[model samples]
Target: MKMKKILWFSILSLLLVIATGCEKEKRAKTKEEQIFPHNLEFAVFELTTHQACKVACGENGEILISLQDVKDDVDTNCSLAQFDSIQMMEQIKIYAYLNINGDSTRLEVPSKPCGTVSYYCKDKSEEVQDVFRLIDEIRDAPAAQGDSAWFFDTFERLFGKGASIDHTPYRIYLAKADPTKFDAPHARLEDYRLIFILTTK
Candidate 1:
C-alpha cells in the first residue's frame, strides 16, 4: 500500500509540471500572434541627425525613422527617392517615437519633407541647388500654427498633389518631436531622443 501511494504522488507531480509548461507555451504563442497579425517581410530602424541646414550647422537634432513592409528590392543602398515611389509608399507604414526627460510620445505617420531624394544626387551642384529650392519653398509657405502643423503642411504641399517622381517602389518618412507633447521648455529637436519601430509585410 505504501509503495502504491508513493508512486501515485510521483505521477501527479510529473503531470503538474507538464501542464504548467504547456500553459506557458500557449501564452507565449498568443502574445506573438497579438503583436504581429500579418506576415512580416522586412523591418529596419535607424537613428540619425535631422539636418536642419546644408552646412556644418550645429542646429541638428537626433531623429529616428523606420521603414516597414518595404519591397525586397529596396535596401540600405537605395536612395530616399527610391523609397518615395507611390506603390511602396502605399504599402508601407512608418512611425517615430520620442522620449524626452522620461516623457514619451509617438508621432504616427510623421511628416516628410519635399525633395528628400535630392540629397542623394551624385551631382554635388544639382544636389545643392535642389536642396536650396526646397528650403526656399518651405520658407515661403504660409506660417504654420505649430511645429506639428508646419511639419505636416510643408510636406503636404508637395506630396498632396501627387508630385511626380522618377523613382519607384518605396516611401520615406521624416519624424520630429513635438514640443507640445512634452513638458520640456526651450526644447530643441536635439533635446529629444527618437526611436523608430518598423514592420515589413
Candidate 2:
C-alpha cells in the first residue's frame, strides 16, 4: 500500500513538471510576433489639377472621399483631356494589422494621370521623358516601402487599357478574422500601392 502511494505521487509530480514547462514556453512568446488586431497601416494620395485630396485612416481603419461630379471615362489620347474634362479625384488611406496569413487592407483608387501608360498620348519619345520625370518625383518622396519601377509597371498596365500586369513581385496577406485561426487566401488587392511611395518624392 505504501509503494502504491509513492508511485502515484511520482506520476503526479511528472505531470506537474510537464505542465509548468508548457506554461513557460507560452510566456516566452511575444504578442507582436503573433497575429492580432493591430499589425499594419497604410496611407494614400491622389493628384488633381487644382488641389490634392487626402484621406487618413481613423478608428475603423478606413477613409472615404466625396466628389461633386465624377467622370468614369475620359479621352486616353489627349493630354489635356485628363484635366480639362475630368471633374474630380478621390484618395483613400488605410490602417491594418500585419499578420502571417494574408494582406487585409485595400486601396481601390483608379489609376491616375501620372502613372498611366500613354502619358496623355504625348508621343512615344515624350512619353518616356514624362515617365522618367514622374519616376524621379516618386524617388524624392519618403516611404518605408516604395519603388519607382513598381509604379511604372502598375500604371502602365492599369491605365494602358487592359494591358497585362505582372503580379510576380507583389505579395498578399490575410486578415486575422479569428485569432485562433490563420488564413492565407482571404486577402486581395484591387491595385498596386507600391508606386505611391516609390514616386512619392
Question: What are the Cα lDDT values of the candidates?
Answer: 0.36, 0.32
Q: What is the lDDT of residue 167 in candidate 1?
A: 26
Compose the digit string of candidate 2's lDDT tens values, residues 107-192: 23333432233224335334434544544444344431234345445434333321111222222211101111012223333221
RMSD values for the candidates in order, in angstroms, are: 19.9, 20.0
lDDT of 2: 0.32
lDDT of 2 at 23: 88
What overall lDDT, based on C-alpha atoms, would model 1 receive against the true structure? 0.36
Candidate 1 lDDT over residue span 1-201, tens digit each = 999999999999999999999999999877755543232221223343342211111135232322221111112222444655665654332233322222244223442322113234465335434544553456445563223346345545443322111122222233222222223434544443332222211
RMSD of 2: 20.0
Q: What lDDT is reached at residue 66 by model 1?
A: 25
Candidate 1 wrongly placed segments (more than 4 Å): 37-201
Error of 2 at 26 (Å): 2.7
